[model samples]
Target: MSVFVASLAFGVISASVLAIASIGFTLQFAVTNVLNLAYAAVMTASAYVAYEVNQAGVVVWVSALVGAAVGATMSYLLNRVVYTPFQRRKASPITLVIVSLGMTLIIEFGTQAFVGGTNVSYTMANGPTLGVGSFVFTGAELGIVAVAVATMVAVHVLIRYTRLGKAMRAAAANRDLARVCGIRTARVVTVTWILSGAVCGLAGVVFGMNAGSFGATSTDIFVVLILAAVFLGGPGEPYGAMVGALVIGLGTEVSAAFIQPDYKDVIAFVILLVMLVARPTGLLGART
Candidate 1:
């Protein structure tokens, strides 16, 4: 029972992080129609920024903000300087993907060079543990969960209530139409980059802080987590990403509890495959 409950808690925390990062990824995909493999590098990059900012007595929230700022700036610059030129040249999808892959290599190794190959941790521990049901967790877990939830809610309210959010949705759904309607799509895309970058970076930093030490490689396969959840939930569907994350997180943990702990990470792929087989659109994803 302890293991079961603990797994549940672990799963929720994992889902929270996954949800936050994947939402950003999905947003980028939705607006640009790009499958940027370099997204994970953005994660490493932002987390490293937070690491540097920590010297100034920065807390998680500030670290998150800094990480997000770096992410947003980098994302926007990449789009403007790299992606935009290539896109205007009518680059093939495969070529764009390759470019992103190249960017990934550059960012990853760059982080290793800049931040060192050594693993680094932000906060040794988060907050105090609280017993909820049969599970327990450090304050970091709770804080991360709260952050994820708040971010999601804020996103939801923005989308549902604000004119800006509606314009963003319109741009994502049909960019050509949006541009025709005077949406100033370039500006909208700029904001999307910032929002998504921040979310991804902040999530990476928080995740690293919670788990202790992490390195650039730690940011690598995590792209799979974000992609799986984002695609599973439906690309660009914020609520769907949240659901997909919870499912994947819980499934990974439960599988580990029942099967081999060593294979915990494998569970994500299994679920991804199963979901693809059942509903190619993903649980919450719309057909592109």
Candidate 2:
């Protein structure tokens, strides 16, 4: 029972991190119409930035913020430098996807060049564990959950109540229509990249925190799960992504209590396959 409950607790934490990363991924795809394979690379780069900041004696939270800044900047630059140029040339979505894959390789190798393919640990101070019944969490884990929830709420409010949010939705639904409606789609796209990239960085930091250590390929490996959640929830649906993350996160961890730990990722892959076969549009995704 304790093991089960512990798995549940860990699942919730994993879900939160997954939610953060998945949301960013969905947002990028929604607004840009590009399946950004490089998003994982962006996360890894941000993790390294956070590591360097932490090594410089900065607090963990502050380092995470710095990582977010770096992510935002990198995302924006990539759009302007790589994506935009190709877009101007009327590149197909498939072409864009291929380009993103190329970017992923470049970023991954670039990270390897600088970090030397070695694992690095963050200097985080441990705190007391908090438990309720059989479930337990550390201070950092609780903080990750809190931040994830807060970020979700903020995103919801922005989308539902703000002008920019509406523009984002409009842009996502139909970019040409949004422009015809007098929306500055260019500006909207820029903001989407920045916001999504910020979340990407935050997720990367929390992911590293949860794992205690990471390497250049750490985020790339995790991207498989993130991609599963994104596809499971609906590619461009943020709320759907959240639900999918929760389901995948809990399912993977809880299943481990009965099966081998190494098979956990297999569960996510199976779920993703089932979802695809049952409903390719996803549980909460809208058909275009």
Candidate 3:
């Protein structure tokens, strides 16, 4: 029972990270209709950016914020310089997906060339351990959960109460109609990428903190879990992503505890496959 509880605790932590990344991914898809396979690449790049700042004697948390900024900038450029141009030419969705894959190879290899193939851990302490009931967490782990909660609340407010939120929803629903209705859809799409990228960057930092080390390819495999969460909650649905994250996080950790740790990712992949077959639209995704 203690072991199960411990796994559950870890699951919550993993879910927190997954939620941040998956939400960003879903938002991008919702607004831009782009299935960006390079999202993980952006995350890896942002984490490396944070690593550089941290190595320069800056605090890790502050360095993470810097990473978020870099992520926003990179995502903006990706859309403006690459994706936007292709979109203007009326590129097919599959072509865009391939392009994103190409970008993923480029970014991942570029980072590897710069950082080498060595795995590097952050130069930060986890601080004191805290226990709640049967669950134990370090200060850094608790901080991650707090950050996830705050991000979720902020996202809720952004989507529910803000003018930008409304415009984003309008654009997602019907870009042409939203444009006809005088919403600057292009601007909304740009903002979506920036906001999502910021979240993606933070998620990458937290992910490294959780694992205690990372490499250029760290986020590459993690993207599978992100996709599982996103698709399980229904692609393009932010709220669904959250639910999916919780489910997948708990499921994978608990399974890892009872089964082979090496197969944890396989568990998530199985769930994703089952979900796709059972309901391709996902739990919250509306049927067309």
The whole-model C-alpha lDDT of candidate 3 against the native structure comes to 0.90
Q: Write the per-residue lDDT of candidate 3 for residues 1-288, one digit (tens) a residue.
A: 478988999899999999988988999899999999999999988988898899999988998898889888889988998899999999999999999999999989999999999988778988889989867789899988888888888888999999999999999999999999999999999999999889888887878877889999988788988889999999988899999999899989999989989999899988888988888888789976
Spell out the clash pairs found in candidate 1: 68-198, 127-139, 233-284, 233-285, 234-285
TM-score of 2: 0.97
Model 2 Cα lDDT, one tens digit per residue, 1-288: 478888988899999999989998898889978788899899989989999999999988899999889889889988999999999999999999999999998998899899997899889886778886766678888888988898889889988899999999999999999999999999999999999998888888888888889998888668889889999998899998899999899989999999999999999989989988888898798765
Query: On a 0 to 100 scale, what is the lDDT of residue 129 in model 1?
Result: 90
Task: Return the lDDT, model 2, position 261.
Answer: 91
Q: Give, for candidate 1, the lowest lDDT window spanning 10 residues.
A: 118-127
Global fold similarity of model 1 (TM-score): 0.95
Off by over 4 Å in 2: none
- Residue pairs that clash (backbone atoms under 3 angstroms), model 2: none
Query: How many residue pairs clash (N, CA or C atoms closer than 3 angstroms) in each of the candidate models, in the order given?
Result: 5, 0, 0
